[model samples]
Structures are given as C-alpha cells and as structure tokens.
Target: MHLILWRIKMSNDNLFSKAEIKYLIKNKDIVIGSFGLAAIILAAMNYGILYLIPGIILTIAALGMRGYKIYKIYERNKKIERTRIKYNFKKIKTMDGYQFEKFVADSLKLIGYKTELTKKSGDFGIDVIAKIENKVIGIQVKHYKGKVGYDAVKEVHSGGKIYKCNEYWVVISNNHGFTRQAKIGAEKLNIKLYDIDDFAYLLDFK
Candidate 1:
C-alpha cells in the first residue's frame, strides 16, 4: 500500500488556515492495518485455526480504526471552516469604538494578518497593531455617528510615528465619512483613510 504523511505548521496566530488543513486531510495516509488485518483474518478463518466469529470481530475493529481517522479529519475541517466564517464582517450600524477595532482585527486575520489591541491608557491614539506580510501597521478606529474631522487624522499620524510602524491607517465607521480637512491632512501625512464604504471595500466585504 502507498503511504503519505502530513504535518501542519503551528504558530501563535493559528495552527493552520482552512486551505492548508483541507490539503493535508486530502492526502492523509490510509492506515496499513486495514488491508493487513483483513487479509490475516481471512487466511486464519480459511485454515480453521480461527473461528468465523473472531475473524468478523477483528475485521470490524480494523475498519473502525480507519473510519475513526476519517471522522477526526472531518471534524478538524469543520472547525477551520467555522473559524473562517467568523472573520466575515458585514455592515455595522451601531458598535462602540472598542468593538469596531476588534471587528477590524478579525477581518485582517482572514487576509493573513496578525493583530493585537493596544492598551487604552497609553496607546497614543492607535487602537490596533497589525502585522501583515512582514509589514507593521498602526490603525486608529473611529466609530463615530457623524463625520470624522482633521483631528482624527492627526492623531493616527502621530501614533504611527510613535509606534514606529511601516504604515498607518485611520478607519471610520461613520455614514458621513471624513471632512475635506481630514482628507487633506491624511494626504499630507501619507496616512490611509477608510470611510464606511472604503472600509468594507478594503476587506472585500462589499
């Protein structure tokens, strides 16, 4: 019988992505004992050394082992799929500032980014610190019901410099979006801004 081996890399972010686990399970090695035990049971029964009842019991046990392995793989796949679903972020009409930051972090995880929430006491206006493709990003989440102004942009720009991140972004979950001054400030500071629609577009949730 042919043999195969599969190993998944474990990390602090996650054990494996949904795609990786699916690939591994697809090539999972079939236990050799299935054919070997069945053949031995048949041979012993034919030689009259083993009774038919014992042969049937051993054959069932071998098959059970094989089935159990397949079941475990199925369970693992289900878990990974569920995790992927959790990252899907739809329209948010009402969420607090902290909730919005956590929601953004979940979406980033779907796209292969690891995120951490900064402490509220001394975060320097940055809410989320994301590491994406070896690039660190400082994000400020403003879940305002009204338009965000230049001050929000200024805070994120300052936070980015203090955190020493490669990139900086200000995301606002506001219907009114940003003011003209805010846009101009973001442009001058080279900071990315994401309004409600823009935020969804970035995550491809739209």
Candidate 2:
C-alpha cells in the first residue's frame, strides 16, 4: 500500500531534487588558523619588526576569540542536554514548530551528534542535519496534534537521500503516534519514526 508509494516517490526524488547547497556556516577557527600560520611564516622569513608586531597581535586576538566561541558552543549544548532531561514535552504544548526543532537538535547534541539547523527557505524538508562519528542523519520535526500522516514520512525519507544523509528520522510530537500508512511508508524507507513515547524514553538515556 503506502510502502509501494514510498518506493515510487524515492525513485523520482533525484529528478525533482534541487542542487544540494550543503552549506555550513564558517566558524572563527578557519580565520584564526590561517592567520596564525601566516604569522609563523612571516616571522620565519625575517619580516620587518612592524609587520611582525601587528601579525602577532592579530593572531593572538584571533586565538582568544576562537577559544571563547568553542567554550560558548559547549556550554550551550550542555544547557540543552540538561533541559531535555528535566523538561517534559507533553507539558509544553505552546512551542512552535521551530522551537520543537531546536529541542530535537539539542537532544541529539546530548547523544554526541553535532546538529546543523537548516535555513527556513529551500531546506528541502529537512529541519536538522545530525552528525555523529562518520554517520549523518536527517531529521524532520512535526509538531502537529493528530496522527502523523504519510506526507511527513515521505518528505524526510526522500529529502534525506537527496541531501546525502546516511539515515533519516521523523519526530512527531503527537501522542497518538503515526498512522498505519505512515508507519508502513517509513518502514519501507528505513526511516526512524519517533512519537511522544520514544521521546520520553530518550530522556532516560544513561
């Protein structure tokens, strides 16, 4: 039934797929690393004292900024991890879809996954890209009330492949869980579906 439809949809994914942007925002380290290396090279080449002084100062400032950014990222992720353990999604029904996606990204961070929040426009149905070790995962967040239908499942499954992700997931906040058709479609595509129960269980991770 839905499984057959899933296969057909995936077969056409490539034809309909947009060019994958695969864009990651640059961090401060890239500039800092290059500047530091150039400074060392300049010093070794016996550059004039004026050039050496400014280069050394700029490199030091860049290093400090890089360190601060890394620490802030670490702290932010830790905060999210703690919030997941203490917070109950059922109690907070007011969060918008964007907020829900952020929560999901935070949970993945606790489990050693680095999450990249995709842009709202031209995201190709993916909300977050989670990477852990060598594996990359595509996740779509659904904040609806009723059962998650086949569309959400199909979108993540096909879009994930187009995005070159190794795995895909659909996170549905609906307590009623997925419809039978949706489940069948997801199973056919090997896409993991997470309902409210599964999210609760994740909070209990050791």
Candidate 3:
C-alpha cells in the first residue's frame, strides 16, 4: 500500500487533472477484472468432488482478503478525515484575533446581518456587536485552546443583560464540549454558544 501511494505521488504533478482520473479509472477496472477472474477460477475448481476442501479453503482466503481490503479502505478514509480537520484547524490557528473577527463578521454579513467590531471590550463581555433589523446582538469571541467552562457561558449571559441586547452568542475555538450543566446554564440565561466545530459549519468550511 505504501509503495502504491509513493508511486502515485511520484507520478502525479497534478493529482486532480485528467491524467490522474484516467489512471484511477484504469486501476479500478483492473482490480474488478482480477476479482472477477479469481471468482471464476474458484467456481471452476469447486466442480471436482475431490477438490471440495481446497475450494472451501480458497473461498475462505478470498473472503479474508476482501475483509482486509475493506478494513484498509475504512482506515484510509478515517485518516483523510483527520488530516482535513487538522489542516482546517491549523489554518484557523494562523489567523490573528482581528482576522478571525473580520472573518466572522463577513460570514454574518453574508447571512444578511450588519456587524460592528468592538475594539473596546464590553464590560458585559461582548467582543462584537451586531444589529439585525432593529435587534442588537452581543457576541463574545473566545480563542481558547482548552475547554470553555460554564463560567464563560455565564459571563456572556450576564453581559447580554448588561448590554440590553436581544440575544447573546459565544463563539469559541478549541474548547471542551458544553456539558449538561453548561447547557442548563445557557438555557436559563438564554445565551447561545457555538464551539469550533459549529463555527466551521456556520461558516461553510466544506
């Protein structure tokens, strides 16, 4: 598998181009042809009564080989997903606070909201102010590396009240999942919190 991957990398200057597509299609066709030939050979061998044991053993081997191939495919897919997420996170990490703020503001604006970037941190914990229609929304942005605890949620909620905003949003990066207590706190305070994964979805990363 490693050898095949290395060969592919060595041959391809543009993996997404027409040449690569043709190569992939040809490889897939060859694999299907090989599997078909193997099945035919196995079936032909089963015709002889004396060859029953050997045929059964061959079929079992084929099944095991297929299973191993399937497992490898699944593993490769998982690895690809992990790599994609890592790349996205690294890209986000390279962005400064102001850049992230602008990104978020642009994203919101795309969704039809007029946004205001606040340089002066609001006492109520608001980092951004957005007005949709006549409603003002307070936003707290957290570029955290670790878990955003219940306290973070509470602060945003309190800030919403102090700012007299219609709604509150807490945007966090690389934080522990909101626990049950945090959920209850958010519900009680009527504050909405979004994790990094949620932000990615909201921003349409994919």
lDDT scores of the candidates, listed in order:
0.72, 0.74, 0.67
TM-score (all chains, Cα) for each model: 0.54, 0.56, 0.50
Q: How would you order the candidates by lDDT, starting with the best?
A: 2, 1, 3
Better of 1 and 2 by TM-score: 2
Q: Per-residue error at 99 for model 2, in Å? A: 0.7
Clashing pairs in 3: 147-176
Ten-residue segment with the worst summed lDDT in candidate 1? 1-10
Off by over 4 Å in 1: 1-91
> lDDT per residue, candidate 3, 62-161, as tens digits?
5666677789677655654564364455566878777676666766776678987777543567777778888888888777676666786887777777
lDDT by residue for model 2 over 95-188, one digit each (tens)?
A: 8888888888887787678998898778888999999888899998888889989998888988898889999988877678999889889888
**How many angstroms is residue 70 displaced in model 1 relative to the true structure, after the best TM-score fit?**
49
List of clashing residue pairs for candidate 1 = none
lDDT of 1: 0.72
Cα lDDT tens digits for candidate 1, 11-83: 3356778566655555333233444465666767685545445555555665676688789767655554454
What's the CA error at residue 92 for candidate 3, in Å?
A: 1.5
* RMSD values, in order shown: 15.6, 17.9, 16.6
Task: For model 3, give the RMSD to the true fold.
Answer: 16.6
